[model samples]
Target: MTTTKERALDAAICLAGSQGIRAMTHARVDAAAGLPKGSTSNHFRTRDALLAGVIARIAEGERADLAPAARGPIHSIDEFVDVFTAVVTTLTGPHADRTRARYALFLELSSDPELQAPLRAQRAAFAELARILLAGLGAKHPDAAVEAFMAFGDGLILHRLTVDPGAPVRRSVAIAVRGCLEA
Candidate 1:
């Protein structure tokens, strides 16, 4: 079952994604989450704490979403493509709001030193997972491949979120993964 904290964090993410970071106040989160007044503040004492909660929630959500792919060694490009496609589809589809909120949080992170470490750790973990997959594909330089793949994915996500919502992110990600595997 989703806990009160989880609900509040989700509300913050949704609020930030839909209405920008400025709209993610405690009262707004409470209202968005259908919690009583001050509920969010009770759980998150400060804005930094609330923001941290959102970041943690994003990381946890990503890890859960990617767990299937991480369960075993990826033995083929198709397997990798499937995993990438699933991730892209979620980011551009059902979870698009969360993804947008994450981007907004990411932009805010640049100015919030307190929140940087967790975000960096989350990113490093994701890169490490990409490296593992790239290694399975016989990538000449798995580290470099991971960086390039992450860059491409991030750019594609940003484009989808900002420039063109109708972009074929799943197809584009599949093609990119295939190209990376072939290189």
Candidate 2:
């Protein structure tokens, strides 16, 4: 059984995946969740508040799904890569369309302080966690390594959406990962 909030968040995620986040509204959310129109008010009270809740929920889901911070000391770094690989595969594969939609929202969010805060917090927290994981791996410049890894991942994602009409994504990620780890 799912609570209204849980179900609403799920609907929001799928909607954000299918349609751009900007296109999702409380009315649409109620419709998507198969609830009466008052349902959004019952849970979140306002549209902006509801959108924030949905974004927070998505962050929570990513944290759980990634699970990179759940491993032991040294192997945690390896596990991080494994978790990252799985996540990238999912986000870029069957979910690709929705992901592009989400990214579009994220780009818009970059210039909106209200939305930027949480997004920045999410990224900063993830970067910090990644830095900690890399530290245990004996990288002399763990912070730099984490930054490089993140930059590489983002670059590959953008590149995937652009040129190299002949290259594969995982192949691109592989090259970045190997280059970062070996460098």
Candidate 3:
């Protein structure tokens, strides 16, 4: 069984994803998690703490999803593109709510430097993975490639999630990957 803290974090992600972040409150989280009134507050104590926990939970889930791809060396641009295409598909499909919640937090709490580290760190971790893959693939400018790829991926994910759900993810990822490799 999941702990009350885990349930509350899960509920917070759901509430933030479905409802807006502003709609997530201790009472609502408790209600959504099927816990008693003070359960969420007892664990989180503050809104920042709750949000931080949610961030950690999302990162944990993402790490699990990406672990297989991250374990081995990606040999070519095609393989890298395939990995990212799968990432975009998953993020825009089954994991859309979690993606939405994370993006919401990116827009909402980004102004607060203290509260922003978790968000930035999550992206940085992904970027590092990309960097390692690019380096392994012999990209001339691995860091630059990582930056371009991450930026493109972020835009592609947001567009697919909001503007066009059917957008060709593999095509977009391939374009980004090829361009990054060439640059």
* Local accuracy of candidate 3 as per-residue lDDT tens digits, 56-113: 9988988876876688998888888888788889988888888999999889997887
Evaluation by lDDT, superior candidate among 1 and 3: 3
Q: How much does candidate 3 score in TM-score?
A: 0.93
Candidate 2 ranges with C-alpha deviation above 4 Å: 76-80, 93-102, 157-171
Shift in Å, residue 92, candidate 3: 1.5
Which rank order by lDDT, best down to worst? 3, 1, 2
Query: Could you tell me how far off, in angstroms, the CA of residue 69 lies in candidate 2 after the best superposition?
Result: 4.2
Q: For residue 124, what is the lDDT in candidate 2?
A: 81
In model 3, which regions exceed 4 Å deviation? none
Candidate lDDT scores, in order, read 0.85, 0.67, 0.88
Candidate 2 local lDDT, 1-183, one digit each (tens): 988888777776677766777667777878998988878778888766776786787677666655645454536344555666666666566555445645665776777779657767777887877677666655567778889988976666555544442335555555555555556
TM-score-wise, the better of 1 and 3 is 3
On lDDT, the leading prediction is 3
Q: What lDDT score is found at residue 84 in candidate 3?
A: 79
lDDT of 1 at 4: 92
Scanning candidate 1 in windows of ten residues, the lowest lDDT window is: 174-183
